[model samples]
Target: MSQAPRRTVVVLAAGEGKRMKSATPKVLHSLLGRTLLGHVLVAAGAAEAEQTVVVVGHQAEQVREHLAEVAPAAVPVLQAVQNGTGHAVRIALEAVPEAAGTVVVLNGDVPLLRPETVASLIAAHESAARAATVLAAAVDDPSGLGRIVRDASGGLARIVEERDASAEEREIREINAGIYVFEAAALRAALGKLSTDNEQGEEYLTDVFGLLVEVGSPVGVFVAPDVEETLGANDRAQLAELRALLRDRVNTAWMRSGVSILDPATAWIDVTVTLEPDAVIDQNTQLKGASAVAAGAVIGPDTTLVDTSVGAGATVLRAHAVGAEIGPEAVVGPFSYLRPGTRLGRKSKIGGFVEAKNSELGEGAKVPHLSYVGDATVGAGANVGAGTIVANYDGVRKSRTVVGEAAFVGSDTVLIAPVEVGPGAYVAAGSVIAKDVPAGNLGVTRAQQRNVEGWTARRRPGSKSAAAAEVAERAAAGAGEVSEAE
Candidate 1:
């Protein structure tokens, strides 16, 4: 009986990352939506690997915690000391337990490496039937990287680290990407012969290629299609560069698939966000974290949506929404805040400067301009006017307000909860409502109009106001006298 080949992946996430200038582990640093190591593990399918061993050192426990959440099946092996890459992999393999099939080793810091690239490397490694394969990239500036030295037949001769490279070798445009595939048995054998005799006084993983070359075992090289994928973030500046590359990739894909991104540079879309065809994303927008926009929806110019859904034909302009749902053809904001639990039905409107929290607005309902709606329900065709407030909180607890269908809540009105306005009711402007308004009734709470003449002139006594009032009074007296004489 032929057994399926077992594949193992070893991730090197053990660097201290002193260049990053932080307490956090290098692999734990996040950009876009995922940590550096999380991205690598996902790209490599480490979770589904027959076996995965993660080598952790600096902040090992923190990295272990992250692995538990993302790739629970992965086995973590602590390298208590900050050793070299060769030493880290040597320790990681000890935890694998399997001595046959294939072993893939990769650095966790290269978050931009794609799954397709990884698949290609493994395929190339097996097809060549070599003892080991090293992924290489020909970059414009290979200054700090290890240069790839090719033999007469173009097979990998050796990798020369920059610090130890001769002037001619440093000029080689092709650099080692620090990603590799090796036959399990061959990798285990080579690691046993590694020594910490390098300039850095650390065991160099690239040294294994030299040992294999001496033994006359062939070494393979797979040049990556995209140099950006071979990049690793050593500091904050490099991390930002990686982030920009990823952002461009995601935005370009969305644009190519019928979604319109008005300005790619200004718009930041998370990898998890989904956009259907005909969706338009305007400048300075950020769609993040499980958010979805259906076809014909237009979002942005300054909007940010996190964990929210925008329905078909909906328009969300200059708004910030989190964990909310905007229904089909609905209109939200020029400056609105939508908190978690908000739901707007079809054709609803949440106008400029409105803030909604834990509320539901039925179809055709509107909370227009400069209002706060919290813990409330507004029925179909209801209109909550500008400056209106549905006060849901008392001293101790929160309550809910209900506005029935066809109800008109006037501007500057405050509907104090546990209250309701019945169907077709009208709550007048400037009212402070404590009780419910019955069907077809008008609720009025403001005091009756009272006139205290010359109040501005008497109380304020401003020179400009007093002068204007005196002149107006003289003109009125003159007109009255002239009418009497006629």
Candidate 2:
């Protein structure tokens, strides 16, 4: 009886991503809601590999830190230098104890790897007992890729890089996909004799195929079902293309899961952004970074939510929310902004042109039109009218404003920071309140108005011309007296 085969996954994630030109490591740059490496690791796990190891090089500590947060169970090893892909694999091999089973190789930058594809490659390698098995694809143009050379029996014989291929060989459309599954013993022996005699002066993992063929061991090829899964991100343009593809996948999956996307083309949903059944999303809406929209939630004709959570039956109309949690049955603006730490309770209403930051509004709280509530706490059943501003920042420090239950704040009211309005209190319209109001009291800060009659007519264009003429006549009389004295 044959024992269960031991399989190990080796992930190559040591590239500096100079083309990305970002301070963050390449694999850490997010695709959809997850880092690229995160996707690769998930795929590997889904393939049912026994052991998985990640090789890290540039910004090793940062990569480790990110991986710890995203996937702590997977093992990690340091490459410690800028080396070729083959050399990176060798560094990863040090972490593996046995070399008898199969070794699966994957690229960290290729986030589209499917578990089925990887499983198929492993099956082909184990069943054929071949020294090496390569994933191959017939690309539109294999100009700069390694060409797959086949033997007389149509088995994969070797791989010739673009620079080394002959004129005729260069025209081959079947190219190496850079994904491979190798027999551990054969891989170790080949890597032992590998040399960096080429122009790049760096060991090439492709060299293992040639070694296997020369040793009378067969080198096999497995064609990918979809070639796009093999494409790796090397720059921002490719990264953007990957992002668009992932967004398309997310939107399509959501549609199939009973969500109605009115305009799928204009809608952008991150990889982990979830929309439950019956959820409707309008055009120009972006659900980003792990946001969740429950059933019956209707999101914008133009809305953007980042790291936000919208509960069931919530309606967000033309709003922008970031790091906020909107409760069930809540209604947020045609033009409202909810910033970090903002929470809107159930049945609450935030009307158009209102902004809230680091604030909490209780159930039934209403802040309608042209108001700014920051660093404040508002109780239940409270009503704040138009043009109300909570002066949260005083020159030196930020403060808070508190409004109790059933409080009525009038239009054009200013709730100075560090002030409070007690329950059942009413603030008069156009009041510039500077102090707290007791329960059941009415706060009115403005002095009595004194209106002068005909003030508007006095300032009209025609009346202003008459007033100018009278002033000119008086000046002329004074000039005449001065001339007589001269």
Candidate 3:
């Protein structure tokens, strides 16, 4: 029987990131709204790996939590205490069910790795049946990287880390990308035989290269296209640069996919965000965290969305939404904000200066101009008038405001917490509704108005006003004469 396809991806995420000086794990630090490991996992997924394992240390629990929450496919295996990359790989090996497949090792911090490059590495390992095939890159300054050295006959030799390399060997520009493809058995054996004799006195995985080469196990290098893919973030500045690069790559890809981005310079999008063809994203818009925009969706000049999915033909006009979902053909504000749990159905309109949180607006519902709806469910075709406030918060506890289908909530109406408006119910303007209104009923709570006529005139024309009039007359006389030519 033919050998089954072999493709296993091992992501090493055990680095301490001491330079970052952050409480968050290194791999968990975000790049373009995703953890570094998240980008690597996505790349592995794109590569169609048979299995993917993540080796985590230094805030392992936090890393595991993020993996569970954001990128579930990346199986987390904690390195109890990070000794080095070799130990990290061994810890990850324990999590692997079977080593029958070809193993591809990658660093979690190297997020810009392309699927093609990973595929090429796997192919190189399989074609030569080599014990190990390292993904290499030619860099201008490989000063601090492991130099890939060869023999006098130009054959593959060994890798020497910067500290271990002599001055002459350190001049070699070709460096290991920290990405490797290995025969599963050879990888396991080599990992088992690794030593910590280096300057750092830490088990260096690079040492395995020499051992594999000495044992007559074939080891080679597959030079990658982009050397920058090997770049890893160790500090805040590097993290920012990585984020910027990712933002550019993502936005450029989106624009090439037929999305019309008005200003690519100011647009920021997460790697996982999916934008359909012909979607229009304006300047200063941030599409973050798995948020997707459907075809023809128009996002704003100052719009910011987090963990939100906008449907086809939806127009989010200068709004900021977090953890919300907008249905097809929905129109949101030029200056509106949607908070967590805000869901709008098809053809719904949420206009300017409105804020909705933990509320569901049904199909064709309209909350136009200056409104606050929270902890509420507004039914289909309901019209929420301007300045409407769903008083869903009390001093002790918050409550819900349920407005039924086709209901009309007038301007400046405060539907106090725990109140409900039944179907077709109408709340009059300026009403402070403290109770629920039944279906088709009108809730109006305005006290009898005793109009005080001439109130403005009575309050005006005081001595202060007379003194001001006299001063105004004197100033008029002293005014410069205008020349009038006939």
Candidate 4:
């Protein structure tokens, strides 16, 4: 059996992206949970390149750090200056061996470029045995792009950048998509001949097409099936457009897989976000990093969840949760906030405006409207009333509260932690319990009421409150006289 060709990929990620107007590097700008360069790197993996080299510039240190996390297999080479695309690719190729075959060169800004597309390009290049093949796309607005100029035989003759092209050449709709596959030896030989003699005083990668044709080598073009796949973002606005396109693509796929996305345009689901069949995604919801919705789970008409998991048949609405686990049949929100470490059990309910963190609510437990349950655990069948507060922090240290099974915590009560509401205990409404309430006991802590005679009249003479008190006292005295007569 013959040995397969040694494939290599050189990813050019050296641009400063001045148009992005961000303190962070352009390739680091994120969308759908992945940075621009990260998406390209994933697609590049499709080619199964034996050797992968990433050229970094303009915040090279940051890019390298991120590469260490996302693409550890790839080698990082610094293009110390913002020379040009050609210069970047040349540096990357230099890091590889001389005999490396079927080298794929690409820009890191094109996030939508799919892996299958990369595979197809490599297949086309190798099967034709061409010196090079340019990935081309026919875009409606080809402005600011390098136009693809073909010869009489309909083969790629040359690539002309917009600045250097004549009016007729600029009118050509087919543009070079800035992705290419080159024969290793041929590319190395051509790079040495490149000069900064273009309109921009830089070594234009487009010039290499003309050089290859002069040597009587076959050069070809692979036009993209989807034009948007070859698109790259230059600014925030363009990035938004790309994100919308990606969102549509992702949501549509999920819908096809039996996930109901009620409003595809408004629902932004990350590419990494997973949803099982029969899961329903409502309008204006964003399911972000590490989020998964089990079958029969319904997520938001308005919600944002990150690193959270919702179990089967659970309902989460208008809630913002991060790093939380919601069990099956649990109901949350209509304005709830679940912070990190929150775990709700089956059939539990966290109602309107409730906020919980570092807490665990057992099965059948309930924390209804206007409550904050933090650093606490509510036992199964416990009912924590509306407006209840678990005071877990006391300035010096954070403590915990444990409400046992079948406990009844009244509305507007505060459970001062280091305390426990024992099983079957009843906490009176509007009470603040600082000590533990034992099983089956009624815990009530409130100051005894004392009504001082004529106090209101003395305190506020001639005031509306004094007038009302005087009338009440007169009516009481009259009633007393009638009782005496009887």
Clashes in each model (backbone N, CA, C under 3 Å)?
0, 0, 0, 0
Compute the lDDT of residue 231 as modeled in candidate 3.
77
Clashes of 2: 0
In candidate 4 the C-alpha lDDT for residue 340 amounts to 98
Reference-based TM-score, model 4: 0.94
lDDT against the true structure, each candidate: 0.92, 0.88, 0.86, 0.93
Sliding window of 10 residues with minimal summed lDDT for model 2: 453-462
Q: Where is model 3 poorest over a 10-residue stretch in terms of lDDT? A: 477-486
Cα-lDDT of candidate 2: 0.88
lDDT order of candidates, top first: 4, 1, 2, 3
Report clash pairs, candidate 3: none
RMSD of 2: 7.1
Q: Write the per-residue lDDT of candidate 2 for residues 373-418, one digit (tens) a residue.
A: 9998888999998999999998999999999899999999999989
Residue-level lDDT for 345 in candidate 3: 98
**Per-residue alpha-carbon lDDT of candidate 3 for residues 1-486, written as tens digits (9 for 90 to 100):** 986677778888877889999988888888786678877777676446777788877888888888888668777887888888888888788788585557888888888887777777777778888888888888998867888998887656998889999999989999988888788888888889988888887778877888898899988888887876777787899888877777788888888989999998899988768889989999999988879999999999899999999999999989999999999999999899999999999999999999999999999999999999999999999999999999887888999889999999999889998988999999999999999899999999988889875454466656676667667766765663332321
Q: For residues 403-455, write the lDDT of model 4, one tens digit per residue.
A: 99999999999999989999999999999999999999999987788878778
TM-scores of the candidates are: 0.95, 0.88, 0.85, 0.94
Q: How many pairs in model 3 have backbone atoms within 3 A of each other, for residues 3 or more apart or on separate chains, i.e. clashes?
A: 0
